[model samples]
Every structure is written in structure tokens, then in C-alpha cells.
Target: MKKGIIYAVLAYLTWGFLPLYWRLFTAMPAWEILAQRITWSFVFVAVLVTVSRQWRRLKSVGSNRRSAAAIVLCSIFISLNWFLFIWAVNNNHVIETSLGYYMNPLISVLFAVVFLRERLSPGQWLSLFLAGLGVLIMAVQYGHIPWVAISLAVSFALYGLAKKIAKLDVLLGLAGETIVALPVALGYLFYIQSQGTGTFTSLPPFSIILLLLSGAATAMPLFWFAKSMQLLPLSFVGFFQYIAPTTSLLLAIFLFNEPFSEGNLISFSLIWLALIIYSFVTFKKSKVKVVPISRADAL
Candidate 1:
């Protein structure tokens, strides 16, 4: 339990600060940065697979068509989520990014009810309604839907759902997802390099080093998150999920100085109220388990 708590805190903290890291590549294109992230993440995880001798497990998973297909779905959603997040952060939509993550748990709940036949309490339903209302308000205020925020929320929620379906060893599963993405990532990177638009050639040596290190930066938090989930109930770990978005919201408002208008405030407040209800309900229903996670708790 202690280890799980520590891991969850670390993962959320790292994720919370990730906008700052992505901001370093603001001068670069989000596509190229995403390609770099995918490529390097694969490299990083491949090395881990080698060192930990998980190659057989990896092969075993690849041999299974259903798990392999699920991983491919994970790769697609996660890749989209990664690209959208980087683009949003670099393009000064940090607050929207924060909003997206803040709404993720609610979206996950909806998916559970819709796809998994899971039941929701009355409190949960009300929470979902409030969150939907908040989103509708945001759309009305913006004169269009906040697609960045919605896409980020939905993509990641789908990624989580796909992960639940994958149901393999965490590291091995991650390795498979990256490997599936590796080819397209490498292809796009080469295309950019050939077109002379690649940051790899034009950026400072320090930036290049940072770009190379982005792989490890991308993977480590995920490893921590997986480890934590393996040691804690989804409901308990889900409680910690708020840390990332809350930190991102603070950084967006105070550090980035994004315009937080009255409408934004109202929308966020409603969503927050919804989350409070949701969390209280979740906690009331949750038991404090001692680090014996089950397959049912995979996501």
C-alpha cells in the first residue's frame, strides 16, 4: 500500500510537470516532437524489455491476436492523445489541457457503464450530469465545442479502456504498444528529416539531448503509474489522478498566465463540484485494500 501510494504520487507529480517539459520544444513542430517521443519511448522500453528479460512475455502477447489487436488500439489512442496534448501545450491551450484531464475520470466512468456493464450510483450519475453540463457550457461559451479538451479526454479514456482489454504484464504490454507505433513514428521522422523541417538537425545540442531523453521522460511516469495501479484499487488510485490536472491548472493559470475568463471559471467550478461528488461517492464505496490487486482492477 505504501509503495502504491508513493508510486501514484510520483506518477501524477511527473505528469503534472510534463507541460513544462513539453514547453521546451515549443519552437518545434508537435508532429515531429510526437514522432520523437514515440521513437525514443520504444527504444527506452525495448531496452527495459531486454534488461528485464521480458522478451518471451512480449512474444507470448504478440502471439495472441486479441491482445495484439487491443494493444494496437492502445497505440492509436495514446499516440493521438500524445500529439494532441503536445500541440495544445505548445499552442497555449494549457488550461484546456488541464480541463481535459480533469474530466477524464468522469469519462472513464461513463465508459465503464456503457461498455463494461458496470453500475453507477445515483451520486455518480449526478456527477456525470454536472460534468456534461459543464462541458456544454464550455461549448456555448467558446461558440463551438472545446475539441482539444474533449479529444484529449476521450482519447485517453479510450486508451485506458484498451489497456484494460490488453490484460498482460504492464511493461510487456507497453512495449507492444510502442513497437506497434514504431514504424509510423520512424517513417514520419524520416520524412520530416528529409524535408529539412526536423528539429533534430536544427535545434541546439542541448535541445537534441533533451529530445533524446524524451523517451525516458515519457515512459517512467507510465511505469510508476502501472506499478501503483498494480498495488492499489482503481478507486483509490483514481483519487490520486486529480493531482496531475490540478497541478496543470495551477501552472496554466499562474505560470503560463493563460486567460482564465469568467466563463472558464464557471465551467471549471461546475466540473469540480461534480468531481467532489464523484470522489466522495467513490471513496465511500471503496475499501482500503492491501496491495493485492486483481485482474478486474487492471485499468
Candidate 2:
């Protein structure tokens, strides 16, 4: 549990500071950044898998055609999510992007209750209602629904849904997503290069290094996240996931100096209230249950 807690914290911290890293590419096109992230992430994830002897696991999943196809479809969704997020950060929509992540847990809870037929407590229902109200307020603030935020949330939820169904090992599943995205990223990079407007060609050496590091940067936290998931319960991991967005919110507000209007404060407050209720409900439910201790606990 100690190891898991440490890994989880490290993973969220890395994710929270991602804006600092990606901001270096602000002068570049979002698509360009997305392309490099995919290409480099593929290389990094491949190496991690190979070093960890997880490659065999990939082969096993590959042999399962249904799982492979599902993963491929989900990979596309995640790539879209990634592209949107990078675009949001570069386009001064970090707060909106943070809002998307803030909505994620509530979205997941809804999915669990509706699709998985999981039971929900009254607190959970109230939490969802408050979250809906918050979203409504945001829509009013923007004079339209924030599609970028919604897309990020929906695409990621679908991606998580795919991951649950794929049932492949973590590293192998990630390798699949990167592999699916690799060709498109390479094609885009080459096309941009041919146009003589490629960021890669014009970037300084340090920028290039950072861009390359983006791959490992992206992969490393994910590796830690997977490790934590192995050691922790789904509920604990689900809660830990919120740390990333909370950190992102801080970065967006203070570090990035994004505008924080009264409406934003109100909307964010509602979201937090909703999250509190959701956590309380979940915790209450948890207390009513009993779990057997495992061999690891015996140690």
C-alpha cells in the first residue's frame, strides 16, 4: 500500500506539471505537438514494454482478434482526446480543460450506475445533480456548451470503458494505442516537413530534446499509474485520478495566469460540492461492505 500510494502521488504530480512541459511547444501547432507526442510515446512505451518483458503479453492480446479490434477503436478515441487536450492548453483553454477532468469522476459514476447496473446512494444522486447544475452554469457562462471539455470527458470515458473491456495488461494495452497512432503521426510529421513549416525543423536543440522527452514524460507517469492500480482498489485509484485535474486547475489559474471570472468560481464551487457529496456517498457505501484480507496484507 505504501508503494502504491507513493507511485500514485508521483503519477498525479507528473500529470499536474504536464502543462509546464507542453507549454514549451506553444509556438507550434497543436497537431504538430500531438504528432510528436504519439510518435515518441510509441517509441518510449515500446522500450518500456520490451525492458519489462511485457512484449509477450502484447503478442497474446494480438492473437485475440476481438480484443485487438476493440483496443484499436479505443486508441482512436484516446488520440482524439489527446489532441483536444493539447490544443486546449495551447489555445488558452486550460481552465476549460480542467473543468472537463473535474467532471470525469461524476461521469464515470454515472456510467457505472447506468451501464454496469451498479447501485448508487442518495448522496451519489445529489452529487450528480449538483454536477449537472455546475455544467449548466458553465454553459450559461460561455453562452454555449463547452464542447472541448465535453469531448475530452466523453472520449476519455469511452477510452476507459474500452480498457475495462480489453482486459489486456496495462503496458501492452498502452503499446496498442501508440502502435495504432504511430502511422498517422508519422504521416502528419512528414507532410508538415514537406511544407517547410515543420516545428521540428525550426526548433532549437533544447526544444527538440524536450519534445523527445515528451514521449518518456507521457509514458512514465502512466507506468506508475498502472503499478498503483495493481496495488490499490478501484475506488482509491478513482479518487487519486482527481489529483491530476486539481493540479491542472492550480497551474491554469496561478501559473498560467488564465482568467478566473466570478462565473468560473461559482461553477467550480458547485463541482467541488458535487464531488464532496459523491465521495461521501461512496465512502459510506464502502463502510457498509466487508473485504477479505489478501496474502499481501499477511506479509
Candidate 3:
């Protein structure tokens, strides 16, 4: 448990620092960032799988038609989420982006109830209500729904839901997603190259290395997260997920010097309150037992 918690914290901390790392690439378009993330992540994962002798496991995911399809779908959604998130960070929308992630855990709970028909305790339900209200308040403040936040939260939640059912090992599953998107990423890079606008060729050597290196940055946290999840309870891992956004919020305010408007303050406060209620409620309830099941039922 200690090791798992440590790993989870490290993963979140790495993810939290990601905005600062990607900020260096602000001069490049988000599309280029997305493409590089895909391409480099592919390389990094391929190496890991090879060294760990997980290559045979890759065949298992590929052979499972339903799982393979689900992974491909997850890849698409994750790609979109990564692109939007990187764009938000690079374009000075980090705080808003952080807000979206602040809402993500709540969204995941909603997705569970709606799609998986999972039951939410009354406290959980109330937490969801508070979170929704927070988002609505933010939307009203902005004079429109913050669709970027909605998109990031919903897409990522769905991706998690699909991964739950797919039952592929994390490394293989992520590899599948990258492989599915590889063609598109490569084509985009090539198209940009043909047009003499390629990030790889046009950028300075250091910048190019950074862009490529971002792939390692991209894969490492995920690799750590996958291992941590395997070692920890889903409940604990869920809470740890919030650290990334919280970090982003601090980075936005302190490091990037983004203005936190009155609306942002109120919205952020509500979000923090909602999460506090939800976390406390969840932690308390996890200690209670509503039912007992046989050994086979555990599966």
C-alpha cells in the first residue's frame, strides 16, 4: 500500500509538472504537440513492452476483437483529451483546464451511474449535484458553458469507462491506441513537412529534442500510473487523480501568472468544497459494508 501510494503520488506530481514542460512548446501549434505526443509515446511504449517481454501480451489485446475496438475508441478520445489539454496549457487557459479536471472525478461517477448502472450512495449523489452546480455557476459566469472543461472531463471519463471493460493490460492498451493513431499522426507530420511547416524540421535542435522527449514525458507517468493502479485500490487511485489538476491550478496562478478573476475564485472554491465533501463521504463509506459476497462473487 505504501509503495502504491508513493507511486501514485509521484505519477500525479509528474502530471502536475506537465503544464510547465509543455509551456515551452507554446510557439508550436497544438496539432504539432499532439502529433509529437503520439509519435514519441509510441516509441517509448514500444521500447518498454519489448524490454519487459510484453510483446506476446500485445497479441492478446489485438486478438480480442471487442477489446481491440474499445481500445481504439479509447485512443481516439484520449488523443483528443491530450490535444485539448496541451492546447489549454500552452494558450493560457490552464486554470480553466484545471477546472475541467477538477470536475472529472465527479463526471466519472456520473458516467458510472449512467453507463454501468452502478449505484451511488446518497452522499455520492449529493457530491455529484454540488459539482454540477459548480460547473453551472462557472458557465453562467463565463456567459456560456465552459465546453473545453466539459469536453475534457467527458471524453476522459468515457475513455476510463471503456478501458474498464476492455480488460487489456495498460501498456498494451495504450500501445494499441497509439498504433491506431500512428497513421494519422505520421500523415500530419508528413503533410506539414511537405508544406514546409513541419515542427521537426523547422524547430531548433533543442526544441526538436524537447518535442521528441515529451514522448518519454508522456509515457512515464502513464507507466507509473498503470503500475500504481495495479498495486493500489481503485478508491485510493481515484483520489490521487485530482492532484494533477490541483497542481495545474497552482502553476497557473503562481508560475504562469494567469489572472484569477472573482468568478474563478468562487468557482474554484465551490469545486474544492464539493471535492472535500465527496472525498470525506467516500472515505467514510468505504469502511462500511452493505453486503457480503462469496469468493466467486468477488470476481
All models: lDDT?
Answer: 0.82, 0.78, 0.78
lDDT of 3 by residue, 49-150 (tens): 898898888887788889888978988888999999988888788877887877777766766667767666677667667766776676677676787888
Q: lDDT by residue for model 2 over 135-230, one digit each (tens)?
A: 677667777788988898788767655665555677887898889889999999999999888978788999999899888998788778667766
State the lDDT at 137 in candidate 1.
Answer: 74
lDDT of 1 at 142: 63
Clashes of 3: 0
lDDT of 1 by residue, 1-299 (tens): 67988998998889889999999998888998999999999999999999999899889889999988998998999899999999999999888888787667667766766776767678878877887787667667667678898899889888776766556688987899899999999999899888877777888999889989999999998888778767765544654666788789889999999877788788878878877898787657654422676899986
CA RMSD per model (angstroms): 4.4, 3.0, 3.5
Where does model 1 exceed 4 Å of error? 1-6, 228-240, 288-299
